[model samples]
Target: MNYILYAVPFFFALIALELLLDRWRGVSTYRFSDTINSLSAGVLSTTVGLLTKAVGLLTYTLAWQQLALVELSAGSLWVWLLAFVLYDFCYYWNHRLGHERNVLWAAHSVHHQSEDYNLSTALRQTSTGFIFGWIFYLPMAVLGVPPVVFLTVAALNLLYQFWVHTRHIPKLGWFEWLFITPSNHRVHHAQNAVYMDRNYGGVFIVWDRLFGTFQEELDAEPVIFGVTTPLASWNPLWANAQFYVALWRDALRAESWWDKLRIWFMRTGWRPADVAAKYPQSKPDLRQFVKFDVPLSLAQKLYAGVQFSLYVLGGTLLLGMGDKLSPAQMLLGVGWMAVGLYALGVWLENRAHAKRLEVARVLLNLPLTWLAVQLSLLSAGPLLWALLLGYSLVSLAALLWTPRTAVGVPA
Candidate 1:
């Protein structure tokens, strides 16, 4: 039923409320470039999922049809309850292995890339998880849980997780013992020595407790958010590819064939002895840690905010119409969106060629709009063309007037 799609509005509303809380408490939890980059990763993940989700659904459906021990009735209340619990149990291991294994961490690290632990951080998801994530849930299919029930519970489990990714919430005393809470989840996100790989349950903390992987949040040792290897940039595409690229480079440099082959499947951060000795990489000093930021002028900030708002709107529309669109149409839309996001990332970085890239993006909108209309992705009309022309002209003016000045600092 695309439950996450339906919850998009509420997600943004809560983010807005969190921003209000930040202002009232005089605490800043979101930075402009960081939040935009986080949301961009999320938007890209959701858009890519529209085309890739079939992999998981089809595999699960085939497994249920062929290997079910017994046919489970979708109408039975017990089936739903059991599936809900079971999905979380599977999710615990999938998430745990995602942190423990190198190849899996390459995909799951997107969620942990954002240094700021805010509501926007929850939306920072992996676009490539579809490749291997479905293997974890095959037990439910084998036990004869219906596909409908599996989908619903999976959505509910994910929906339950969104609210736990904030810093404003304090520990819920007794409530913190059994279920996943904000405090415990914050510990899960922390990169501290004490908190590195603990607390991996999706809905039930009972799984972590039973498996000996739970850690309580401590006031004496405050959580340091983000991964050990900082992402250090606002580019969404690079954020997803950063770890994989590192692993690839390591694999290429290893002297042993066995080391090269096993590097991907080895434990997270395990490098060949040769590679480690030659190209050493060290975790940043916690005491000297500073959040990654880039300077931006006021005009640049306003332009970025307005452009990001448009992408959010466009991405939401694409999601709503996903079922009705052709694959070609979806590909074209997603491709254009990706280019726009990359340009925005460059702008945030204040790169030398950012102005030219942005100007190209603004100009490309006209032909892309015409292509979309011709492809039946958009309706043919004069009003649409007029609106596109007006937006491009305004965007071009802003791009020209906004000097490529690095005077203003990130908020």
Candidate 2:
């Protein structure tokens, strides 16, 4: 039913409300670049999911048709309740393994990369999770839970998670014990040794409690957010690829084929003895920890905000019509959006060539729009052409008017 897509506006509204609360209380929770980068990862995940979601759906449908122990009726209330509870049970192990195993963490680490935890951070999802995530829910299929029930409960579970990402919410008195709340979820996101791998429940906190993985939020030790291996850049693409690249390089350096093969499945952060000795990695001390940031002029911030808004609008449109579009059209739209996002990341980094890259990106849109029309993905009309021309001209004018001194020094 596309519950996630329909919840987009609601998500942004709460983010806006959170921003307002931050101002009123004089406590800062969101950084501009961090929020944008997190949302960019999320947008990329959704757009890419359009192409990759079929993998999980097809596999689950096949498993259900062939291996179901009994046929379960979706109309039965008990079936829905049972599936809702079971899905979270599956999610607990999937999420726990995602943190415990190297291969899985490579995909799940994107969500933990952000140092600033906010509503935007909730949207910071892993695009590569489709690879192994489908296996977690196969138990439901085997139990004869209908596919419709599985998907609905999955969406509801995810939606239930969005509100728990805020810093403004304090610990709920008794609700903290049985359900996943903002307080416990914050502990889940923390990188401190005490909080590193605890609190993995989705909708229910009971699973963590029963399994002895629960950790209460402590008053003495304040939570420090983010991962041990900091994602030090604002680039979304690099954020997704960073851990995988690290593992790949380590595997290449190992002398033994067994170490190379086992490194991926071993406990998270396990490296070959040779690689560990030659090129060791150390965790930063929490006392001196600093969040990643880049200095930017007012113009740069405004430009980034405006351009990101356009991508958000474009991404929303693509998601809404994704099933209706041809494969060629979908590819072109997704590719163009991805390139634009990459350029935006470069701009946030304030690289010396960022202005030129942005100018080139703005110019390319004219032809891309024409191509979209030619492919019949977009309709041909004078108004469409006029709007495109106006946007390009205005964008070019803004780029030309931006001062050379305003190009921020790369962090």
Runs off by more than 4 Å, candidate 2 = 404-411
lDDT of 2 by residue, 1-411 (tens): 799899999999999999999999999999999999999999999998888888888899999999999999999999999999999999999999999999999999999999988999999998899999999999999999988999999999999999999999999999999999999999999999999999999989999999999999999989999999999888888888999999999999999999999999999999999999999999999999999888877788888899999999999999998888888898998898889989999988888888899999998998899888898888855677899889888888988876544445464
lDDT of 1: 0.93
Instruction: Report the Cα lDDT for residue 400, model 2.
Output: 80
lDDT of 1 at 358: 91
For residue 35, give model 2's deviation from the true position in Å.
Answer: 0.4
Q: Estimate each model's TM-score.
A: 0.98, 0.98
Model 1 Cα RMSD, 1 decimal: 1.8
lDDT of 1 by residue, 112-229 (tens): 9888899999999998889899999999999999999999999999999999999999999888988999999999999899998899999999999999999999999999999999
Error of 1 at 107 (Å): 0.4
Error of model 1, residue 306, in angstroms? 0.4
